[model samples]
Target chain A: MPYPKVDVDEWRLSVKGCVEEPLHLTYNDLLRLPQITQSVTLECAGNKRALRDPKTRGEQFLLGAISNAVWTGVPLQTILYLAGIRPEAQEIVFQGMDVGFRTDIPDLLSYSRSLPVTKAIHPDTLLALFMNYEPLPAKHGFPVRLVVPGWYAMGSVKWLRRILVIEHPFDGPYQSRDYVLYTRPDDYAHGVPITEIQVNSSIAYPTDQQTVRRGNQYVYGIAWSGSNNVTEIDISTDGGHIWQPADWIDSEQRYTWRRWSFHWKADLPGEYMIMSRASDESGAVQRQQALWNVKGYVNNSIHQVKVYVE
Target chain B: MPYPKVDVDEWRLSVKGCVEEPLHLTYNDLLRLPQITQSVTLECAGNKRALRDPKTRGEQFLLGAISNAVWTGVPLQTILYLAGIRPEAQEIVFQGMDVGFRTDIPDLLSYSRSLPVTKAIHPDTLLALFMNYEPLPAKHGFPVRLVVPGWYAMGSVKWLRRILVIEHPFDGPYQSRDYVLYTRPDDYAHGVPITEIQVNSSIAYPTDQQTVRRGNQYVYGIAWSGSNNVTEIDISTDGGHIWQPADWIDSEQRYTWRRWSFHWKADLPGEYMIMSRASDESGAVQRQQALWNVKGYVNNSIHQVKVYVE
Candidate 1:
């Protein structure tokens, strides 16, 4: 998709809906507010879409659909508090300037998604203006983008144009139709909205079918969990038959992936299968099989690799 | 295990038992015969032992317990034909010069394994003297190692010292006791002998949790089958939601792994789960779950990885 062009001089972030004051703030006004910076990991909801069984419909994404960066922005709660959010407001909807026509939808629609009032008031939620210490690139929702720390990237609407505080739920296309996980392919009525990222881990070294000289080798990878911090990582050099605890290479942090490594000696010459399983403080352990959903959301199965030692 | 020293000048390979003619051949005499070279992949029967759910015993080998090498040697059939096998012969037993005392067995025992006469006489079976164009390394069964191309490495008795044509099945410890796969963990009477390698594949690039720049990326891996050739490789960029056919990087060859790759474009910055599933000409497809075995043998489950794109 091409980046939607926005002229900063005429840009205004409109904050309306169930609030005491409806405010229109220019780009400079947002920059003038007290700024904060934080590092967060963002993962696409459809990250492992291709790994789902029975298949799914959408862009087939691999593990590279996620990234981490330092974002600079104003706390979303500050804006909500300044606007004096009405007590009756049930949800806050953020809309993007980018518009597109979808085959499933009759009218051209601007991308938008909603968050509960509780989440909107959370201090970690941000109206981000900068990524990695620089102004956001046009592709990354320049001018302003909503950053929801614990939810999937789909909830973090980009190219912010307006915010609406609604007394009831917002049934937008992205919320009502897309990004909904239908247990049965045809059962859309009981679909569930994808939210938190699942606890997961992946093997990074001695990659699948990688051949290495028989000796000491390090099996490295990363692990992450939504909201909760990753607490343990297990390494299985021989597939999942037996697991040995792995050491953390990075300290624990919320909303960011953790790096881990296991010291392994490939003393014998032959083929091997390697695996990594992760668990989070929330007590979520990476399973051998992820639940099947029509949209292929939230897959956190154990990662595996086949390696050869020569 | 340390390699035992062998005085080549005085060492001889004895062929006896049910053979019509018993014979002893010196190292130089065997080398003078017709020689052939082939690339074969040898896997340990206990490979992926750590992947077994219940956790099997023995050396906790990973995928590296296997390797492919160009072996030069005289076919076992040529030697068997010279020795003139009798019609009553049922199996051919091969023993290594190395001996050891085990806790389970009181007396010293040589590492011995037997093969059916049909497998023993197969033209592909060899008494290998050279590995990758070089003389066999001491640790890799110096002098002559029985190279059973399609079977597990357990059948390839190293440090060849003796061969026997038996009228009945050889009930050696390596055959009836150790290498046997007990289905119920205690069902000694219903155990199966581990043999032929299963069809399998592994991803070698975009390692698990690897962060790559959003652009064109090559997802590379390798696939191999026991006696059959790998006919297809399917790549899934999203956990397993959908699959696309992968291109073969190397032509199909028997007994050796074939390289494969998928050209992937990490156009968007996010997390993705990558997987590779392989199918052989024998109609064997790499499944999501490997069957549970007491010894964790023949695990050919699909391989996966988690990668991040920036």
Candidate 2:
């Protein structure tokens, strides 16, 4: 069904869910409301898992979907409060505009995600309407969207249309279909619904297979853990035998990656190696090998690369 | 002084801090060592800060030095084995090839930073010598750098030269001079050293004051916080009275901005206002009022823009 021919200036965002008075937000209504801003590290729910094979190619990025951008919108809870929600509303749902292959289901469907009413009403959550001070692009969801910070990108639905307050989880692929993790075969694939992403690190510079000489080389890279920023990063040149530590650039919070570097000299010429590891606020460290899944969602395996030393 | 030009293929990182053995590494040797890749978020020590007023454009962004990149290097500990230093080497000092800065300071001074010896052996650290699957760019410090996961950007020194295991912090401008807060006076009279960034956000698209049309306008922007990953964003249409949440795009780390949108309707004809705010992983959010400081390192104020309603 055709949504409407309304202009964005007079657009009204209807807020209906576990609230008090289903509220309708106008363009001015949104702009006039108090504003909020924060620095967040966003990673695609399916970021960087394709580089495992030698044939992988693109921007040379490891299946990248992680990027940082500023977002503006309204507090979802503020609208929920105005909307007058019923006590039975235990969940909050968001729907987006993109339609892609999402499992055995043939026809494409809009992206959608739902969270417990508790997580939904948190002040940190927003009903996103603007990106980088501009209107949304067609490819990036033009009309409306939901901003759930610290959660997987899946939950922040784009091209959002309606929000429903329910008691159980939604029947969309986001909840029951794709994001679930089953530890054991019979252990029930139903794992903790993906909400906040795990703390992770990456070697941004000096990717695998780089060539180097026997001289001076400074090592550098980034590290971050979704809800919990990076607290530490370690480097190993002799295959983990000896270690060195660089410096931390920021000390605000441990949820973001802090830049670090180490300067070293190579006396003899031969095949050399390089490696870096990181840990987050919760003390979760990057493991040597990440648990493999059919669809590589959280491939937090120890990332290793080879460089030719002549 | 010009440092040695090492061949990328024959380089090996040597870590010789307080470790048991001063290990030696080769380029390939570093790769062969236990390697890990993580999608961590990175935020510049000084990101998002503006001096109010139309003529108040000191610098549009204090948000440089912040970026999320994958790092591949040797664990710092393994390299320390090559030196077999005395246990008293409590400070891990790192120097980089990015020796000279555009500053008025005379002569070339390689950048440097240092950390506690304990952190040097931490497993998540790295002595990175390459960037983005390639050798470090000259602009980004060619030889090597340090990865300190969750600290400030200052710690990641570039164009490495030396690693001194000292008993005290290195006293240098590059290490303690640039990138600091401006508490000396309201206008950076005697700026202090900056250890971290503050909450910050921005509108990447339409930009400030850009006239937008009526119809389904996609509002867009980017947001970020210091070491915390942005977890929430809100938009205001009625000048802060009422607000609506937007759809927040997922990214690789907290340092990057989030792409978000909202569909505004311009059914009626008149002037309109727009604003945005961000919240981080630590639950710290941006306020509407901006603060004044010396260097304007961390300025996270509400971003405002205007549009017309049809």
Candidate 3:
């Protein structure tokens, strides 16, 4: 599939359904609103598909689908309030301008998502028009896009076009069926939406399969939680028996990954599985293995790299 | 500064204050209650003091302040129910058998914590009597201990002695003064109790400063978000420009650290900074720097390590 080509001049954002006053606004109208800027991170639901199987299926995202950027936009809450949301509205569906066929659905439909009304009205939710201070890129979502803070990239519907308020749970294929966790033995019947990103950490140096001479060295890596701050990172040179603390550098910026450094004295001449672990404020711990699921969503496990020392 | 020794035969856990029926129970009485086993992770508020400044001014913790084990205990809710908590009770204070003096307090006071009634009566809250299938050890908590799941280790007051149901927010030095986040510039006035363990991650292999030969290498680590699940881990071998995904090696287990691995092919001979980033279900992200506070609590930033390639 190719990225959608949208005519900015012809594009219009429409807010309809379950509102006393529906909205039909052009790009200029959105620009007229007082702009707010925020640095938000978006991660594809399948960022680690390879964790499920070395050979991935459907979409194989090898870390390219995740990024953080400063976004400029109008608060979605302002528009929701101006439209006069009906008290009866239970859901708010955002539809992207990009249309495509899906194997999960019987008919062609625009990429869309139905968010709980409460989530739709959150102050952080935005109808973003810019990425990194520039007009939203075509591939990213030009004209307008929904920037859902603290949620997976799927929640941030790019190339957004329609905002529909409805009275029932959105049972679209992505909502009720596709983007869910089948990690439970019962399968999809008891699955949950892959909403928030999980806590995870990884090593970036000594490129995998890189050999190192026996002497003093160091290991560098980054770690982040979806919305909460990372408290600590531990590094182990001896498989899993012992762990050493790593020091974080710089400021703890919200919605962004933090950097940490550890002094490693690689004194042995053998293959070593250098590992790192991360823990968040909410008490969630990374596992040694990915939770196997039908959809393979939210597979945050411990990160390890095998390195040789000679 | 040593663990208090208590004769289990004579120790009595008293349930008084704001209860319809004040009761006194001994060690044997607690064992009679239906036992439930749970695996919970406990972390000290100062788990990563070395991450701040190597020479810590206050209590220092390296990676050893955290552990997870199976606990056998009776639900705190059951005892609360039997005691008939008065509607006016707003706080539930767990007082440990150990008593000591603190700089903030005028007189000796038992190491204690005040929990909200709601949290005190949570189904998972327990008055644990055994750990890892064995009777609680003296250093860990002898006769009985309050085990508050999903909270920092301080909330699990050891060597339990008394349970006080009070009608107001407990204002003991530990509650209103110590354990609060002094990271804010203004200091203690706006501080918050260090309740839950902050999100954190660590590397377990390639002992710090260890030397490595140039060739193929693997990086490993573990991650956790207090009570939530980890979602993603990104690795960057070339500073921060490009990131590669690390594969989780095992199944996702609750209340435990996860393991992940990355494949690196180091073709050059030079120093490299390997890093990792993690995200959690609660949407918390690791920061680039620790959130500075007077007490330095909840500093979950990204982790990195330095290594030489020759």
The candidate that wins on lDDT is 1
What digit string (tens of lDDT, one per residue) describes model 3 on residues A1-310?
Answer: 7777788789888999999999998899999998788887777777766445433233534434577789999999999998999999999999987787653444778888988988888888888998998998888988788998878888899888899999888888778776887766445578878777787776776544455667777888877778776677888877778988888974576666767888888876777888888877777767887777765666566777667775
Clash tally, candidates in order: 46, 247, 173
Ranking by DockQ: 1, 2, 3
State the lDDT at B25 in candidate 1: 94
lDDT tens string, model 1, A67-162?
A: 889999999998898899998999999999899866455578899999999888888999999999999999999999999998889998999999
CA error at residue A132 for candidate 3, angstroms: 1.2
Query: Fnat per model, in the order given?
Result: 0.00, 0.00, 0.00
**For residues A121-226, could you state the per-residue lDDT of candidate 2 as single tens digits?**
8887876667777765554555566777787677777666667776666778668756765544435445655667766656654555444555676666666677
Write one digit per residue (lDDT tens) for candidate 1, span B1-310. 5787788899899999988788899999888999999999888877666445455545555456778899999999998999999999999999998898654566898999999998998999999999999999988888999999878789989999999999998898889877776768556788888778888887878665456767788999888888888899999999999999999988988888888989998799787999899998989998987766655667677878778775
Candidate 1 lDDT: 0.85
lDDT of 2 at A220: 66
Docking class of 1: incorrect
Interface RMSD of each: 13.3, 16.4, 22.2
Compared with the true structure, all predictions reach lDDT values of 0.85, 0.62, 0.77
lDDT of 2 at A156: 75
User: After superposition, which runs of candidate 2 have C-alpha atoms over 4 Å from their true positions?
Assistant: A1-11, A51-63, A100-103, A106-108, A130-144, A184-189, B1-310
> Worst ten-residue run, lDDT, model 1 chain B?
B50-59
State the lDDT of candidate 3 residue by residue for B69-129, as single tens digits.
8889999998999899999999999988788755344588788899999889888888999
**TM-score for all models, in order of appearance:** 0.52, 0.47, 0.49
